[model samples]
Target: MESTAIGLWGVPLAILAGAIRVSTPFIFVSLGETITERSGRINLGLEGTLVFGAMTAYAVAVMTGSPWLGVLAAMATGAVFGTIHGWICKWPKVNDIAIGIAMMQFGLGLAFFLGKAFIKPAAPHLPSIPFGAWSSYPQIQAALNINVLFIIGAVLAVLLWWAFRNTRMGLILRVVGDSTDAARAIGINPDRIRLLATAVGGSLAAVGGAYLSLYYPGSWNEGISSGQGLMAVALVIFARWNPIGCFLAALLFGGAGALGPALQSVGVSEGYYLFYAAPYVMTLVIMIITSSPTRSLSGAPGALSITK
Candidate 1:
């Protein structure tokens, strides 16, 4: 009876903890997509990249006994995938959307085929900092146990925001995104710029994947991503392409995601399954509220194919 009473209080703490944990992947993926779209291109195949990165991270960790090394390996493979997508989309006749779909399918199939061997092995999980050590309550301690990647993602958001507004590279990227003709007139190679941007984006998305397989779920599973990669595209739109905005939006999505499990923990089992739809419903509502058939989204890159 006493534990049940504690459980009631634990519900909010659990949700708070879950929000931070779940939001980490969203932060990385959405920020990555932001970079890609900011370069006047989009790669819808990050879903595949996320899945494959999970598989690769798990496999490498199992082999090398170092989770950090696995993350580096995932980034390398993800960049390669992004490079391929960028190269194909640069062709005049190819469609970026279509090519992105193809790449996604290829990544999924490849990951599945290669991931079978690593499923049974136990790899080292990423370490976390006990921010809750100052608390006497277990729930508080648990809620405060922060992951390193979450901190990294937060710092990255601020850095990207600053870089976008103040750096020379940011100027070039903005010029390319706003107008290819403008970029060319300025003697900038838009294609090369976009390719690099996409590569960097893919690498960041893979870090999100690494977080999944090496930390949260801590396994190499084909189903780990749960469509987070695809939904992040919507997240980017919701964020208005701002890195800091992406971080906040990711936390909102993560809170929605945590709703189901949080309620379950507190004995609110009735209709708990419905809560799983919270994030999707939130996404739909955000899309409806933000989208207008008459005009491109405010802050969208002028040269972006999606906006056109």
Candidate 2:
């Protein structure tokens, strides 16, 4: 079947499609970080974790011929990385930021060294839902081919938003985030809560990585994450640690990320490359606008060191 081209109209369609496709990773990473930050901890090493997860997922998919298994493997490894970071930061006098940075380097180096063998092998890809089947246009079909993980991420966001407002666990997380003394008064262990939160965050971040290698880019590469993991830290702040906000913000960021590729696809070659930087530029702008020397961000966790 021949693809139906719609001329200039393809640009917006491509961007709409790309936004959904590219936003999946951002959605996952930002949601993961939202959970971690809400629990009063920050993991700057998520970039390393993201890359390492991509490598792990790709390697496993290549060996096992099952992308789902690869995703599981990535999640397990990510949780372990998170556990290490959480445990180290729990030590007296240890700085979470410093430890997070170290873990990021460690994850990156380990992934690069071990990923060398599987770089060239083709891995099984995750399946997508063909929502555009009724359309005759190929671009519409491509745009509507929604991945399973994207749906999962969307559901997860709603679930998380509800959980934060209506669950006992959410209450505990909030208490711990607000104050260690308050958590202690309530017979809760702040360190334990933070550790578990970090581990959960790591697992989710890894899922984002798996989406990259097994779905979108569909390959293992050293630079696959494109600093998206680090960017998620900023995204969590941008979303005010709200799961629903994270989802919407991820979509916006995804659209910005898609700008360059969408323009190039439409034959707008000149100056299109610069649009690739739109997401990062947007991040910087958001940070500058939100930051204030005199007042802490409204939704920031009281126990979070960055807020202090």
Candidate 3:
């Protein structure tokens, strides 16, 4: 009876907490993916970039004793990776998707080889605001804790959405993404614009990895990410490529990803594992709902390869 009473209050709180914790990575990665896709390219190798980012962040933190620097290192390295991908895909007849896959494998191999020594080192974690301070229950307080990165992501989403609508740079990017001929007619370099966009996207994705290794689950390990990188591709689709939509979608995914654990916390252990499927299920449902036979995804870049 007491456990049930506790769960009545606890489950919702746990899920909320889970949503924040799990959503941070999704937001960063999906936002990154959104930026790249908006420029008419898709980066499947983000999984590799993500893993490599986590490894790089962890290793740098261990060496420098500063988590922020670790994140910066990850961002810089991710940019290099993205730059490589962008440069390679600019060539005639080169496939971006294939290059992404190769990059993913290469990154994974490199991270594993380089990250071996740092597995046991303890790195400092990012600071979090105690939004749960008013709650008397320890569990409740813990659940309400919010991190700084989440704040940055939320603000970033709104900024990107606004930029896409109002900025000249955003206009140029859209033009390039929608039509290379249009870009050429306007004397804009399509390849150069894509290269810059890809670099920014790679840096954003690396920030997600830094959050994973330096914060929640807070460790340097091979199994740290549960395909958040690839899943963000679907997430980008679900968000209709809108930055704000990406943020909301990320929170939804976070809540879903946290559902199983939240249920377990409420003593609903049996069948709780099924709830772990929530994010993937949501992804499928969204995809089905969004699919169309006659047109590309409503907001998708015209030049993007994966059209409906």
Candidate 4:
């Protein structure tokens, strides 16, 4: 794809493509976090899980020559990590947030130590759908290249939003999240539900990591994730714990993050670097806008407020 062939429209088209590519991880992580938070637990260690999952996915893909298998491995490891966090936090007087921080460092160190041999290996990349193939323009073709995971993430968002409202399991999760006493009276174990929710969240976050290593930037590195896991926590909050809102917010964040590269692609390089900070800046702004000391978030679980 030559820049001369792409007109001024290339910039926006490129940004749109970048937004979809960049948003995949955010969508997975934010949706996963929504599930965890809805069950009244927050996993701050997801950054570690995300990175570690990236490493695991790359290593597995290199060894097995199957990107999908690598993704499965990452999900399994993430489940283990989540289960550990849940188990530790269930103990008397244990602090979930503090444990999550410790786990973050632990995951990072472990990944770097184990992934040294995998740094140089080439792995199979995930496949994408060329939505713009009908167009003669190269820029359009490149811009509309949508990956399988992004499509799955988008569908999952809608499914989750619907499930939360209509499913019996969803009702149980909501009840467990809202009040411990109420859950107990209803014969549901809050600890157990939170544990399962956290485990599921961990797996989902890992899938996001797999997408990063197997597609998009499409490589394994220590810095593959730029605090996206942490950013997703605020995103879940900003979305008011709604699954559909999480999906849309991820796209917004993704588009913001993509603004810099999109402009640079069109030869507008000078100030585009500043736009690279869009994701972080947007996260901070949304957090400030949504936070209130006296009132809980509109859709927040009642039990989660005590942690604040």
Model 2 lDDT at residue 251: 91
Q: Tell me each candidate's RMSD, in Å, in order.
A: 1.4, 1.2, 1.8, 1.4
Q: Which residue pairs collide, candidate 4? A: none
Q: Report the candidate with higher TM-score, 1 versus 3.
A: 1
Which residues of candidate 4, in runs, are more than 4 Å off? Answer: 1-6, 305-308
The local distance difference test score of model 3 is: 0.89
Report the Cα lDDT for candidate 1.
0.91
By TM-score, the best candidate is: 2
Quantify how close model 1 is to the true structure by its C-alpha RMSD in Å: 1.4
The per-prediction tally of clashing pairs is 0, 0, 0, 0
What digit string (tens of lDDT, one per residue) describes model 2 on residues 32-61? 888888889999999988999999999999
Q: What alpha-carbon RMSD in Å does predicted model 3 have with respect to the real structure?
A: 1.8
TM-scores of all candidate predictions against the true structure:
0.97, 0.98, 0.96, 0.97
Clash pairs for candidate 2: none
Q: Which portions of model 1 miss their true places by more than 4 Å?
A: 1-8
Segments of candidate 3 deviating more than 4 angstroms: 1-7
Candidate 4 TM-score, true structure as reference: 0.97
lDDT of each: 0.91, 0.92, 0.89, 0.90
Residue-wise C-alpha lDDT for candidate 3, range 33-132, written one tens digit per residue: 8889888888988988888999999889989989899999999988988899899989989888999999989988898999999999899887899987
Greater-lDDT candidate between 1 and 3: 1
